[model samples]
Target chain A: MSFEKVEHALHKRRKSRNIGLGAVLIGFVALVFVLTIAKVVDEGDAQRAEQALRINPPKASE
Target chain B: MSDASLNTTTQDGDAGFGDFFALLKPRVMSLVVFTALVGLLAAPVPVNPIVAFASILFIAVGGGASGALNMWWDADIDRIMKRTQSRPIPAGRLSEGDALGLGATLSVFAVVMLFLASNIVAAGLLAFTIFFYVVIYTMWLKRWTPQNIVIGGAAGAFPPMIGWAVATGGISIESVLMFTIVFMWTPPHFWALALFMKSDYRDAGVPMLTVTHGRTSTRKHILVYTLLLAPIAIGTAFTSIGGPVYLAAAVVLNALFIKGAITIWRRDETQAEADGYRTEKRFFALSLVYLFAHFLAILAEAGLGQFGLGGWA
Candidate 1:
């Protein structure tokens, strides 16, 4: 291949690679969103558990 | 205007203190410092403030030393990798010999200073962390196996445990859990970067997951490791160091981490390539926040406990 053609091919490959990386970045943002939702849900459970523990301490067998 | 001017310009092109410092990988060092500080703060034993500061400083120095040594050894391959091409040694700004000398000096200084500031066990762990990163991980595993990051992750995990030892004078389940969180987190985190930087690793002849096993397999491994990391991270909440703050962070971060992995797994190479590896880059960035958030949560819990308001206590 000519020098210009080789350079063009390399540039194309780099561009494609950059695009691939961008897709991954979008996916990561979506994942972060999902996890944030999950944490909100879990926080509710933690609060409930705290309330339960406070209201009814474990029975003792002295 | 003369030959002397030319010589001066050539000398200026060579690396000085700033270049050598970059080789120490300050960003990685910061993460090490943050996690180690969390470990120290979360320990049940009360350490003197001065000693605690000194010990953590030594640990950070130890981490930097490890980075420098890694750069020294990996300079050859680094020159071939585009992502690492501008690094000090690889860019011809700093000599490999200088890196070795600096790394060796810092290694001794960090370890000996840690010994003075803390107990023998903490100091020993710091020494071993440096050895593992430099000799075992960098020298042997990085070139020899695809599981390099998996096994080598232990070196990064040791800082927190060492920090814990610095305060408590021994290891505990809590410290081990902190160690496990980072250890489990490393593979998925690094694999995401590997997926996008596949060509660089291939060019450098480094057997990263994407280069050796292929991108599909690398994505699957990332998903698998992230799945494993979720439980380990959440489970920390049941430990002494865990509280509402950490539990909240873990639950949120792990969910996001897993979702990210799954998205990456689902995408075809063409689609991902079209998107400029967006998912991959996001995963790598999130991985950074994941670790920092977890440690920050631990620190928050410790602070709350000090104020007599923590549920974990």
Candidate 2:
């Protein structure tokens, strides 16, 4: 190939498998949304568990 | 530039998806992820599982961003160095501008995502780590000073602390100790490699410890840093993330590390070269294992802590 053609090819050839990169970016976005929900759910669970512990006084004796 | 036979695209350009990914330095990113995971898991507070996952992922991304930017900036020196000549930027698979763009994008993305997933503190620390690595270390200190790795080591040391912040939403002694462990470990670990690979830094004009101070000074520094590292390594056993399992592991590891350092300190370059730098090479390899084992032991202690059977009184 000619020199200029090779230079053009160099840049063009770099990202052929960008499908996988796209998928990963999508996955990252999905994970962020999932984590927001998980935090809410986990907080709710913690509150319920705290209430239960208070009522039951579930402490181990030293 | 002397070897006549190797000519493909004239070492100029052309690469695929793998080249871009290679620019991220996945190996270093994995270490960042592992240490950050241990820090998160070992924290006293519980994090939402998905949040924890996201936080670690962002931290990895941030670390990768640092690597990419470093590669972009260091491409010139990298091309001259045998050890680093094949990196994406240096190998001409990716342009320096492309690396800089990707790294900047990832740095912002990771930090913002971390803030969304965890807390501002974690995200802030991640941003700082990335900046310190790319700007302070790669762009500035690396060429200017021999002690580049010492202060620059803070960038690598921040992940666990960032992980701690992800879980607890704050820093504490435990997280600080984790940060310090990696920080103290960096000088000796890198200088050991410097002992054997001084030629690379010399040729690259990168001002590594060996290039500036000579092998003898580097050796002494390694032994001194190892001595400084031992107490910290063993002392972590009494911390929240440590237990008998950790103490035992650390004791054995540190003893062997000290032995290795002493041997390296005692050896002259002639002796080292005569044996093909075997002692230095062995020490360098062991340093990797040593750091990983320490982190793994901390993780083990965390598992035991979960069972109410860990930590010293």
Using lDDT, give the best candidate's number: 2
Give the range of the ten consecutive residues with the poorest summed lDDT in model 2 chain B: B1-10
- What would the per-residue lDDT of candidate 2 be over residues B1-313, giving only the tens digit for each residue? 2222234452333467777789889999999999999999999998777788888988999999999999888888889999998887777667988888889999999999899888899999999999899889888898999999999999999999999999989999999999999999999989988888868999988889898888999999999999999999999998888889999999999999999999999999999999999999999999999999999999988888778877775
Candidate 2 regions with alpha-carbon error over 4 angstroms: A1-16, A43-62, B1-14
Tens digit of per-residue lDDT, candidate 1, span B1-313: 3334334332322444456668679989988988899999999887766567768878988999999999999989989999889898777767888789879999998898788667899999999999999999999999989999999999999989998999899999999999999999999989888888768888888888888888899989998999988998999888888888888888999889889989998987998889999989998999999998998898888888888866465
RMSD (Å) of each candidate, 1 decimal:
15.6, 5.8
iRMS (Å) per candidate: 16.0, 6.5
In model 1, the runs with Cα more than 4 Å from the true position are A1-62, B1-6, B10-14
- DockQ values of all predictions: 0.02, 0.33
Top DockQ prediction, candidate number: 2
User: How many Å off is the CA of B101 in candidate 2?
Assistant: 0.4
Alpha-carbon interface RMSD of model 2? Answer: 6.5
Return model 1's CA RMSD, one decimal: 15.6
